[model samples]
Target: MPFDFPLIATIAAVFLLAGFVKGVIGLGLPTISVGLLSLVMAPAQAAALLIVPSVITNLQQMRPTATLLPLARRLWSMMLGVILGTLAAGGLIAGANAAGAAAALGAALVLYAAIGLIQVRFQVAPRHEAWAAPVVGGLTGMVTAATGVFVLPAVPYLQAIGLEKDALVQALGLSFLVSTLALALTLSGAGVFTWASVLTLVPALAGQVVGQWLRTRIDAVTFRRWFFAGLLALGAFLALRWLLA
Candidate 1:
């Protein structure tokens, strides 16, 4: 497959921005990259381009070996649900029309932005985690399979679990890692995975370095405000584009 220079350029720019967002917030690489990429390509294609960068960056975030095993044990049920749900919905995005997938992606982004901006929080009792985790994971996986975004109930559920700040970040990384791998498997099975996504790694990592450097100097809260606002607008535009098409 010949690389389209313009499309590649767009991808580079999008991943750079997406990586920067992830560096600061510890998430959003796939969500932002796929959401923006869907503007120019199908959701499945955008998802393909994101697989490599998402996996690498997420692995970087899941650090401090001591914490990983504990977190993994606690979240194993959710992780299992993620894999099952993603595989179940694997063909939905690949089989959908471009416009339909774009609309789904756009709607996911919009819902995510709304949740972030409004700061919606939920509480899951410790005893309920066994049941709650799998359900949330399954829904999140279905969302990822359909739209290539995996933040919705997953992020909210993580926050509600009352993890300490550091634990929350690491947990997020672990959950995202699981989701990315599940999505990758689904994409591969659906014939949407592409080795060409490797080309995006450089720009994505470069942007992440810069964003991490800036994270220490800036107010993440303020930046998050602007980020959600921008995402809200972008999502609205994409959804409306589909509606009016």
Candidate 2:
């Protein structure tokens, strides 16, 4: 179905909001955007619309962080796992029904929010993490491509390793960028990208800028508390809507 004008405006507004939240919290752009957009569009279309903008916007988010080559080298194995996982789960995403897909995604967000509430911190040895990396990365990659879900069983492992904030942000950004690029290329081969998808970028970019600006003024802890709460709220709202519908 073609997008009506009102739908376009609503998506633009949601992206702008999602971006602001990401800027403040170091993540959430995709989660928030995907959650909100699925309300108005097919899950496949929502995922496609985000592919170009997420790559561009995440690059901007990653620009502020300094290089941590040593750390990056350590994480390469995890990245590899993410790639394999994406390839494994990528096909299932496009086939999911919109409401069912959204509900699944919403449940994941709720789980992430609950984990965030625990404020858990840990210290794991590299060897242990090395073993764990593939499992987490692969799951992260698959959900990211399909439903924009990037929480527990994926991101938490990165956080647990005591990765520095800047490096962590870049790592997350790079993961999404790589996976999305792969997804985009695959979809393009399958004739998925189109003018309407291209049209969604303008508002998405606008939101990214706004989100970055919001990032600076907020205290990190406060920002995270509210951010996760929003995720929980978004998930709850979606669940209720689905039940009602």
Q: Best by TM-score, which number?
A: 1
TM-score of each: 0.97, 0.86
Quantify how close model 1 is to the true structure by its C-alpha RMSD in Å. 1.0
lDDT of 1 at 40: 81
The lDDT per prediction is 0.88, 0.70
Tens-place lDDT per residue, model 2, 157-183, is 877777787787877776666666766
In terms of lDDT, the poorest run of 10 residues in model 1 is: 90-99
Error of 1 at 148 (Å): 0.7
Clashing pairs in 2: 16-207, 19-211, 20-211
Total colliding residue pairs, candidate 1: 0
